[model samples]
Target: MSDRDTTSLLTPELEPQMDSLNPEPAPRPSRPRQMTLNMGPQHPSTHGVLRVVLELDGENIVSARPDIGYLHTGIEKECEVKTWQQVVTLTDRVDYLSNLANNLVYALTVEKLIGDIEIPSKAQWLRVMMCELSRLNSHLVWLGTHAIDIGAMSVFFYCFREREDILRILEMFSGQRMMTSYIRIGGVALEPPRGWREAVGKFLKQFPSKVDEYDELLENNPIWLNRTKGVGFISLEDMLDLGVTGPMLRGAGLKLDVRKTEPYSSYEKFDFDVPVYTDNDVYSRYRVRLDEMRQSTRIIKQALEGMPEGPWQADAPKIVLPEREKMKTQMEALIYHFKIVTEGFRVPAGEAFQAVESPRGEIAYYIVSNGTTRPYRVFMRTPSFGNLQSLGTLLEGRLLADSIAALGSMDFVLGDVDR
Candidate 1:
């Protein structure tokens, strides 16, 4: 072979190099470095069947997308087939932790459609008391599970210990612990059960101290503070734009509770302050809910001490069910009871929207009636669905480990989200 050809074969062509004094590194391939992770439709920290799609750059999240509907119940569509009265049972499952709050919002929406049906003052006060109790139940569950998510195991047991008392009180009133279906359209399903005052009074008396116990366990703990305090922050404007509500909204320093801003079910009669904090972070949300539990206790005390004396149900024989005793003795009462149970009472043809403060946030029901026994259309504006919208804003740009703290702070129920 020629010398030139042998030299060409021995040495490959080389690219020009930079000056030795100013050497530049070779450019890296321009492709995304992010990895996508699925956090769960089964992961325990999700608090329900929620799947979060996360894009991560190393240990930090680049973006997050909440993929929901793993727990969809089709409850709103189910309502179209059920009688107005029969639908109350279904509401209890929407947010099982706050069943009474669901029951109340549903009952209030029906009552509005029925044209100013006069709910007794006693019933109103009782509804308020029960709803507050439901709030406490929800907050307890949130705190317990959230603490455990952050590795504070002891707080879970302490929270459930107090929660058992609230559940007992609820059972006394409705005869069912979680799915009571106690709040009816015209009024509550039945008069407050005997000895309810004593049961609730005992819980109220001890609950403040129980809350203090939780505070001691979490508020000053270095591990908890490190995990939560400055993490999971989203701006107030972004939260509002995303339609986030409940303690998340309150924690961002916005005083927009449905109970306080738009009172229903005699909530105006109760004197309680809506807790607000300015931090707009996970710890602020924790503080707001703690303060809320105390306020709920205050409302329950007022309801217990000043419960009015009147018929628990409305005077409308056609709408409210007759007493069992009256049904046995009186033919008219028997017919009304039979009709309400079998045929269901017809609401006037109209549409009504009622919003109430549930444990998670502003839960509103928009119901349409065609002057029929069943609702024409039923739609629920659930807080979990609204608050979940902020997940992207909250988790993006945060450390992957911090996602758990941010998610736990939102306190969403999947049933509520997907219903």
Candidate 2:
């Protein structure tokens, strides 16, 4: 008591709690501690096994920390073990929603490394069409799932209806819906499947109206508007600093699409507007992706109409596989096919980075070839990883109820994040 009185500025009567050391724990402050919550190593809204640690002051989020790596497949290190062609399958698993884009970028990097390899015009156009469809497929899933996350459950059904059509198209080409890996180095996996044009034409014709239907359902709905608009705001400067791209960057009004800025796989030939929104909120990201679906339909229509008449693969027999029929009859073709199947083609010694605009964002593959059938080093600069870095920025100081909208707005694939 005497020590406290000597140290206190006020008189002994005014020296409130008496002892400074261990003063009855300050009566527990009469306030609750901020509750810490783990939102998904398996939460549906997370889109994958993404764990976000949130500190909540009542319903308001005090802070959020994203804990990732639960879905890590070690794909990059695994790429080093696979042949040049075999790595495409690994890339497919990197972003489950956008396998075609993965195939295209990795193939493009290999093509660049090989040098002087001419991808046929038909193949390029086909690649463009498939990739754009992939973009549509991805956005549809994002729209459906994100809508459901925000409680617009009906939109989810409509979005999945359209997504089924796109997946059917993919299956027609690759025999697998999600991991088609159709886009291959120097060409596509197959000459566009028979009746592919008719199938695509059917889907494209009905797709626009369906998109309009989604707008009808959600564009003006009060709940959707309330949950998304003016929520989860991150400045354009912050987005750039965090390396956020795709619709996230576009929503910030940056217009920084790798497709437009650095067109690959004949993307420069397409005429489609890059959707941009200046609001930089969850609603803005939603609008940008919806508009992107329309633009993708536009590109697909153009691709189908101007579909080229040429080989579907380059004239590199050593690199590209001969037809299955050719393998059976022609001894020379059989030998080459066997050789390519058993031992992958050797890429020239060099390094190349090929970045493509995937559904999520910029998906680039950096390949270092040491004159080997397998990559000496392979690295992926995935957009989900970049976009995930901004989760804290989006969630901090926001309401807990808004977390789903904020997370879904990023449209990140956990495989892409953890790869």
Q: Which candidate is the best by TM-score?
A: 1
RMSD of each: 4.5, 6.0
Cα RMSD for predicted model 2:
6.0
In model 2, pairs of residues that clash are none
TM-scores vs. true structure, each candidate: 0.93, 0.92
Residue 396 miss distance in model 1 (angstroms): 1.1
- Candidate 1 wrongly placed segments (more than 4 Å): 1-30
Candidate 1 at residue 417, lDDT? 93
How many Å off is the CA of 305 in candidate 1?
Answer: 0.6
lDDT of each: 0.91, 0.90
- Tens digit of per-residue lDDT, candidate 1, span 326-414: 99999999999889889999999999999999999999999999999999999999999999999999998999999999999999999
| Global Cα lDDT for candidate 1 | 0.91
Q: Write the per-residue lDDT of candidate 2 for residues 250-292, one digit (tens) a residue.
A: 9988888998898887888989999999998999999999999
Which pairs of residues collide in candidate 1?
Answer: none
